[model samples]
Each structure stands twice: as structure tokens, then as C-alpha cells.
Target: MSESDLQDNNPLDPGDNSNLASGEGHSEDAPPFVPGLDGDPGSDQEEANNLEESTPVESDAFNAHVFEGQFEPNITSYQIIWQGSPNYWAGRGGNKIVAICDHIMQGSMESANSWFKNAASEVSAHFGVARDGRIYQWVRVENGAWTNGIMNRPDTSLPWLAEAIQKKINPNLLTIGIEHEGLTGQVFPEAQYQATLWLHRNLIQNYGIQPDRQHIIGHYQIDAVNRPGCPGTGFPWQRLLTDLGATQPKTTTLTSSSSSGGFLTGPVPGVVSGAFGPGTVNTNNAYVRSYPSFGAGVMVLRKLPAGTLLKFIAYTDQGAVYKGNSRWYLIDFTDKGGWIHSLMIS
Candidate 1:
């Protein structure tokens, strides 16, 4: 469908985004979970120190397109407009983009489109994906959009992120922001997911961005304090990472004993409880969502690393099944009940 047609069908009126700033489109109030990290607060300091000691790589080779005056659209198949008032001039010769970040409108596509076009909101993303998977670009890939507020700061704490920020490579300049139409923790439509996957593939290939967790992170990872549950927990991160051929890290074994603050670590030797059986997560970075379904609004509670044992307290026949199983198991994670696809559990 065309961009105008998609906007016309949006549920919210144009420029009416009252819920975006409220808790409507935000993720649940949960502690920040960084993939490949053990959820240790001190890890950030350690990483920062390591980055300080390492040699900084010159990004001159990555800026050839801007220097040569050759600009290519990241997604040529979508509709785009030069709504220039809301964005900033990306310094570093406009060739600093190296990552892709996702966000939820927490409202309607029409509202988001209008907001970016209004110039009053002072926020814009490079692309906006409608529920039907229609894509609209507000800013060119070469310039920085004001979608992410964290980009305004330079002293990022994460070691893997320190170098990028130190070189002024914030999300506004180094990442292509794509806002999806939906609330936080809601299921994202299949079409929208497909469109995002296509866009990501092109961006990764075109920008030479390493298809890994560190490079392609959610908004929460950038500024966990202010944007904790952005793009929410239900965003099938493992599936996307696997599809991108991103390198996987070795699984960390969870320790047994609920008293130790670990959920079920590994499978219980002899545990059986009808459909609510016990199983171990076989894949690293397996997602436990608030709902069984896959979509934009689906909330992810936590991403359990490999070998975390969990009990299948309940099951749902509905939802996407990656493996041969169509059932999703509900489990208690972090004192809250959440769902996970049965295929990821052993």
C-alpha cells in the first residue's frame, strides 16, 4: 500500500500522539538486561576501562561514501520524504552510521508520521513501519534523526559502546532508527517484521555493520536508565540475530537452587507435571516473553541464556513455533509469569 493510504487507515488521528510519552508504548518496569553480559552492574565499568586501554580504530575507511559524494538509500523499495526540520546535521561528514535501532510508536502510524512531519515534536526516525509492513522514510540515511535522546550524551558506560560515542558516533549519527507502529510488549505484525528484516539486511550489507548483538542493539541498551523497555522484551532478538548470521557466544550454565536467585538452572533430574513439564533452554539468549504470540506488542520479560532450566507451567496452542512444536509454555521468570516458544527449550 502507499504511504498516504496507510496513514489514512491508521487508528489514531494525525498528530495525536498522547500515548507516546506515557507508559503506553513503553516496556514493563524491569531491570535492564544486556545480552552477553551476566547482568552485573560492575560489568559496565570494566568494559569502559577495557575500551579506554584499547587502541581506537579510525573510521575514515567507513566514511568513503560521504567523502566521495555518493549517497545510497538504505531501503530503496520504501516511500521516503525529506522532512528536514526535526533532524540534526550528522557530523563526521555524514558517513558515521554503523548500527540500526528499533522503536515502537506507542501510538498509530499516522500519528507518528504526523509528529515527525510537524516539526513541533522535535523527534524523527529514518524510517517508520506500518502494521501492514509499509515503510516510510522521513530522513535520509546520511543525516541524523532526533529519534533517540541518548545520542545527545557522549560518555556512554558500556565498553563496547565507548569507542563509538567517544568518536561522536551516537545513534543519531551512527544508527538508522526505525519506528514500528504498536505498543510496547505487543505482537508485531508478521509483515512489519519481514520489512524490518529486509531493511536490516540491506543496512548491514551496505554499511559493513557486523551483524552482532553489540552493533545492532535495542534502544534500551544504549540508555537503559531512561529508555529501559524500548522495543520491549518480546522483540524476538535471538531469532533476528540468528537470521542475520550473527556470531553466537558460548552458553553460560545457570546455577541450580531458586534460593541462589537463579531460576531453574538446568533440567531437574526427574520432574514431570503433565503439560506443565520441565525443560532446559537449549539456545543461548532465549527470550521469555509476556505473551506466547510473536508481534510488535509482545513484551519480553527476560532473555535467558542457554542452560537455564524452566518449568512449563502452562501451554498455548496459538503463536509462532520455530520448531515442529506449535505450543508455547508459560513459565515463572523473575517472579513474574512469561511465555517462551517450546522449540527453544530442550
Candidate 2:
């Protein structure tokens, strides 16, 4: 909850932030190529309405700070369930933490968790809060989930998002997203509110995020044109800020760091880190294969232009050796996310 819990390794320059403002940012599978739009408000609100309130369960465990911004064994009192998702950028590609955005799943937490786990979906938020006050973490705070990627809508008038839009940066890089499992218009239960309140306070404390309307915002603010009712009108914004109660931002600057091509937090004690960031295509008309290998049965998903940006999710030697190298990288895309030989992206 504290920005202190998150780090800003690659602070975004106000100008370079503009380079990623609109398009060429998130993968195509991601939504809102235009603006906010989650079709049916709450496809399963009836099911969510019957939820029971849960007491905040205490815990002393930590998380494996997936990226530089988040520290391992996340410090929290509430029992947090961690389920790592592949649908996120390994790191912010150097952008620092700035705001925490809230979203309403309009469905069940189980659905959100399942969606995030599927790499083919190419979407994720950092945390998810169930109607019963249970907390679940999918993507790490340090990485950029596919949640709020770009401000592509024509109308960019929301004050809460003015600074973000003017900066012209990929909102996903600067923001940590927390999804609430519920509908847009339904009243939030006290237990759920308190749980989210604890998270917001911690984010403010750790990252130095100011406890205010602008810093702590809803998903609608970013793309009011399309998703004006995202975290819905029922979210108690004023109450959350009042409870947070730190009048001013704790610090003037945010800090973060990256490893393994700007991938993980530092090194996990036993897990080995490898190249896991964005890479440019080095070859001309390269094909992203259905599988990592070059031999039989592999289908060509599509062709890529030279210098096209590709998100390399993981590296392995499972594919047949190509160009005297066995390194094959799994790249995230709209179509089931294909794997490309390292030589094309090396």
C-alpha cells in the first residue's frame, strides 16, 4: 500500500513520457484502442451481491518482490494470497511509480485471477480485492500490467488524469492498479473498503504517493470517454482520502532499480534471473513462430518488421538450435503470445 513498498528505478522524464502517451504502447490484445468500455456494466453483479463480509486475517509473510519497485515478502498485516501472472511487463522499462488506480472487475475475483494468469489475454492489474475483503496479488508493483496502458480517448478532460496525460507517459508504467471484485453502481461493504484503505495507506507510505484525489484515483479518470463508470460512482473516494490523512506528499522524488535487462527486483535467493524486458527485432521480415522451435509442426503466426518492439516474457533452450544458438524467447502478443528465436530479437 505504501509507495515505500514500491520503488521507481527508472524515473520517467516528463518529455520522454510523451513518446509513449498514445499508441505503440500496450500489446494489441489489450483493450481501449479508443477509450473506456467494459461492455455490460456488471455481467455478474447478482452473484457479487450475495457476498459475505470477511474479517481481516493477519499475516507476517512477505512476497518475492517481482520487480525493483516491490520488495519481497510484501510487508502487510492482512493475509495476502499471491498468484504470479505472466500478463505483465517484467519492469517499467525505467518509469517510476506515481499513482495507484482503482478498478471494478464487474465480475468475480476468481475470474480476474484466472484472466491474469493466462498469458494469451495480455492483461493484468497488480492486486485484486474481493467483496469479502480478501486480498490477492497478481502482478508485482514494479512491473507494468496491461491495465491502464494508454490514454487513447479523444476527450482527455479528467483533472485526476491531467498530470498523467500532460506527461504523455504510459499510465501503466507509473501506476499500480488494484481491482475490486464487484459492480460499478453497488455500494461497497465496510470490510472491503477498510481492506483497500489499508492497501492505499501502505502505498502512500512506501512510495511517497500523496494521499489525495489525483494520486489515488479510479479507472474512469484515465479514460472517461469510454469507461466513465469503471470503479463506478459508488467507490467512497473522499472517505478513503480522509482516512489516509497525510496532507502532503512525503517526498519530492521517487526511486527504483532493475536487473536482468531491467526485469526483476534484484535476485531472488534461489531463482535465477534472465533477460525479461522489451527487445527490438534485429532481422528483417522475421516470423514469430507458433512454438519456439524451427522444425516440423511450428506455424508462423505473423511477420514482423525490422526494429519492431517485442515483449520478451521468458527465455529458454527448449526450441531447436537456430543460427548456432538455442536461446528462444517467448513473446507476448494478442494471438496466444508466440515464441520467437532470440536471434531475431537479439
The top-ranked prediction according to lDDT is: 2
lDDT of 1 by residue, 1-346 (tens): 1212111222211122246743332222212222332322224543243223212122243234122332234433433322323333333244556677877777787777666654345566777777787766665566556666643112132344667655544445567778888776777778878767766766777767788766777675564334534676556676788978898644322233342233332332212123344567655666676555555565565777667877654444334533212345657443355666654554
lDDT of 2 by residue, 1-346 (tens): 1111111232111112111112222233253322232211112432132122322223433323322244324433566667656665555657678888888776778877767665566667888888888898776576666786445331232243555567655677778899888766677898788789877777776677877755786765565323445676667765888788845323211111121222222212212123354666654667766555554565666677677876654555334543223445666543235666654553
Query: In candidate 2, which residue ranges exceed 4 Å CA deviation?
Result: 1-59, 63-76, 153-167, 246-346
Locate the minimum summed-lDDT window of 10 residues in model 1.
5-14
**Reference-based lDDT, residue 263, model 2:** 24
In model 1, the Cα lDDT at residue 154 comes to 21
- Residue 95 of model 1: what lDDT? 53
- In angstroms, give how far residue 68 of model 2 lies from its true place: 8.9
Candidate 2's C-alpha lDDT? 0.56
